[model samples]
Target: MLNFERLQILQKYYDYIQKKTGVRDYFLVGGALRDILLGIKEKLDDVDLTIAGEPIGLYAQMEKEAFSHFITEKFGTITLIPKEGVMQGIKYEITPFREESGYQDVRHPDDIRWTNSLLADAKRRDFRINAMYYRFLNIKKPVYEEKKVLDSTTLLKVLDREGFVFLENSGVLIVQNSSLIDQLLQNGQMDSDFLYYLLDIQHFAYCYGEEGEKTDSDGRFDLQIVIDPEYGIHSLINRKLETVGDPDIRFQEDALRLLRGLRFVNVINQKLLNNENKEQNADPLNKVRLFDFETETWKSIKKNHDLLKTIAKERIYQEIVKSFSEGNPFGLVALVDEAEMLPILFPALAKTKGYDQPIRYHPFDIYAHIILTLWHLQQINSNYLVRFAMLYHDVGKVGQYEQYGLNLTREEIRNILAGPLNHRFSSAELMKEDFRNLGFSNKEIEEIKRYINEHHTPGEILMGNSQNWTKRLRKLFSEVGYEKLQNLLDINIADRLGMYNPLQNSSDLTDSYYLKTLVDEIEQTEGQFKKSDLAITGADVMEHFDLKPGKLIGELLQVGFDWVLGDVKHRNVKKQILANIANYLKQKK
Candidate 1:
């Protein structure tokens, strides 16, 4: 529980309620106490406060205060999230203290009875870690520290001192009673939603606190504690952090537990070498494989873009927008395993080569390379959400539409392996349709679409460059849009990593690492056409030469763009560019 932020917001809201309607002793139950001990923070976007013995007008005060971007009401409990910034839409729900009876749904109690006891309200939470509570008289001013351990420092130290403290390390404070966990697991309670999400859907489980609550025995007060890995809370915090705080909540929450899995793995490998620990952690666990971004895009396509159908387009758009602006997309793509999603992503290709890569060039062979690329991607930046644009980019290669392959023997043979020239183009269209489905706004789709199309354009430019690396990069940036230049490199990296021969037209260029020399060499110097150093734009060339902004001007820009890429000094006046274009066009003219 990140009690400070959680309670602070609740306290502020309660104080506000007191000021407006004179509501006192409002009950703040669930997750608030858990977050405080778990080293988490609260979001002021929406404040949820469970009013004691009342199910009305929780928002009379909020309606009077900073409520521009918000809408308020009381169905049973009051929910208010600050309607400022991206988090403006996030909701903070305040419910009246209530005891639940009879399970009509998997996670919700069918009947509700308003209660005055703190334990009754807290018992409704899914896990023990999420079931703690604190109550205050009003929201205007709060005594936050009372009976509340409001920071992670105290609990973290103790948990760290106790190694193999898996439950504590989870950052969720578990209650001693087991009944809460058991009840939530049963159908008809709202907790079943979380149970299904973590257990059936995601296949992860809660590390329940082993002890029991001595004071409250029907297990009504008992709760299991575990970190909420779902992005909702993180997303809520992420939307608000930009306004006043840093964006990383996990770092402040409990960085120890944040990378605990990675840390454990590292220690295991180290100790296995030195035999430091008595019991060996390894038991020859089979390596798991997942889809790379490209493969997942194909699978998503087969699923008919069903993933983001439930979330708002704006939310998806914002995430995509942030991904492009703040994160590494290629690396994110590497996490997706195309193999697992074959039938869905590129059923067309899966039937032909069986979605297999040409093994002679790849070490892990085709299936393994996809997984390898995702692994390599994880080693880089794990923060950014890779775009579906890039994810669907190479999916066309997976499906082997018999008609696509070109063979001299017969039309049937040619049709056997090669696809139409528009294979990737069709894939792009599918991607565009799913852009919003994948959580992108329409405005974001345009940029992403261009990025996808042009990802391969740079490789084509390099091929046409007669082996000019610097020229290739310049052409890539200018023509493709310079924003995702590094993204292009990441895509190239994934492509090379997933193949035996990603470079040459033939199998001759099989070794993936061999390109490191060339790629590094490209990185060591400047790219071909940096925006600051550019000699001329299409408009400039057309206006200067008294030329129409037609095919002629287009040709001139391409020629001039290439020229400037080869020589940095061409970034000067338009005279040299016009002169060169004159001569080049005169010869063709």
Candidate 2:
């Protein structure tokens, strides 16, 4: 059942819509419903509803009331964002009851047949666990008493089954079975002549976890719910992942479902593992196991994995972002490799599977090293760009190793490390094309490339003394600002933890901490790493040096900027910068 606070908010919208269109047969469906049953309350800020008629007319009416809406006419869907009211910041998407067929392009339906049957809509969903629905029932207003009525044997039975909510503030008791209310009235359990006359209490029942056929002789359950037609609640309890119908037909209709199915498994399995220790005391013998793909689902994925090529790169990138945002990217990456989807999704990265590195430094092959890096990175940072940088950080080494062969002398490998600029540049160039195909903006591509370039800087600084570190660190700070440097440090730490180098030790991490301290100190004393940090600006240089508004003024400002970075104390002394630039111009003689 939905919580009282969110349910109350949803009730307001339901009342608003019912007053306008007189449509009472609608459902809260899809992921919002699935998550609520999983004991996940934080992600229920959005709601998805499937109504019994065309959504365009209702959307048009909502537009008149000044609610912003985006519609897809082909699918009869509308995403409505409320600009004002008690439901502000909550997103609501409404789709008319419809069935789909003839997916020629493997994504959209070639024809959508609108219907009043909720079962048809449930059958068209991708996964069984996502097919359940939640809807309220129509019942006479419940009689309210000043004394406690929660102890009524009839109401207690419904509440024990976990499908009812009692709104304490409004004195409205909501139950799924109207039959239970009849019993309450007959037993004279309430203090009123009639059920409390609460008009807004209509949206209160949670009709889920049962079959449509199992209802009262009056067929009241059939009227309010088509819950679990695919046995979704059963599968959810066992931690299973299976397609709603035929796996092959579903995957062929939309190949992106292949990856999405795996992402679901990965995320749900992570949640199950996290809850295992907590659940041990509650039921030691019946602890829930992690999720596994149903047998047919696994077989279908292997057969149709190649169909991913037909999907758009931008769409694929969106799925990747969603998986990474869930905080267990390594699990998803590993599952992608196990399913053989890695070769189709990232051919270059797949080629690194058996590529060897210097055994003295790396214990795993390039592919295993990359995977381990992602695992370690989760402990330090969850930024997608930081993770991506570590993924491709050593991809260029595949080509380098091929050129040198596996028999290179240790001295030759040592020389490669001394100047790894070539491989870093090569890796960044390769990442550029991948990012462009994934629809990243030009600015985002450049920022990620800069991170790739500086990935090795932290380890290099770890080898230097504090005096040399200050000079190099300040130069880097001036170039990339503080946040990017912090991200680079995170990548460096994960990379080290992924390796088995004898040259690196616990002291390396100790040095990393010192470097972080220095970064904070530099930022606190020098302020932002921009021209504003300099005591003199372009105008000041032009005025004090008698220079015109041209390139010379900009160059003289850089001179002052560099002087301040040399010693932050110089920033507070304008005369020192003027004298420094004066000496710099004299040197131009």
**TM-scores for every predicted model:** 0.52, 0.78
Could you tell me the TM-score of candidate 1?
0.52
- In the range 1-589, model 2's lDDT, one tens digit per residue, is 2222233324445555454334555567777656545644444467788766666775665533545668888788887666776666667778977889998889888999887666667779999888866554444333233423232343435444643444443323444333443332332122233333322333443233222223345533211222445666556655678998999999999999999998888776666555565564767675666778889999999899999888888888888777776637888888888888987766667888988888878877998888888788877787877777777777777777775776779887777655553567767777787767766678877887888877888878777776778767887887888888888888887888888566645225777767878889988876556666666778878888888899888888877777777677645478888998999999998
Model 2 segments more than 4 A misplaced:
1-22, 56-66, 138-226, 271-289, 406-421, 506-508, 538-559, 581-589
Winning model by lDDT: 2
> What is candidate 1's local distance difference test score?
0.41
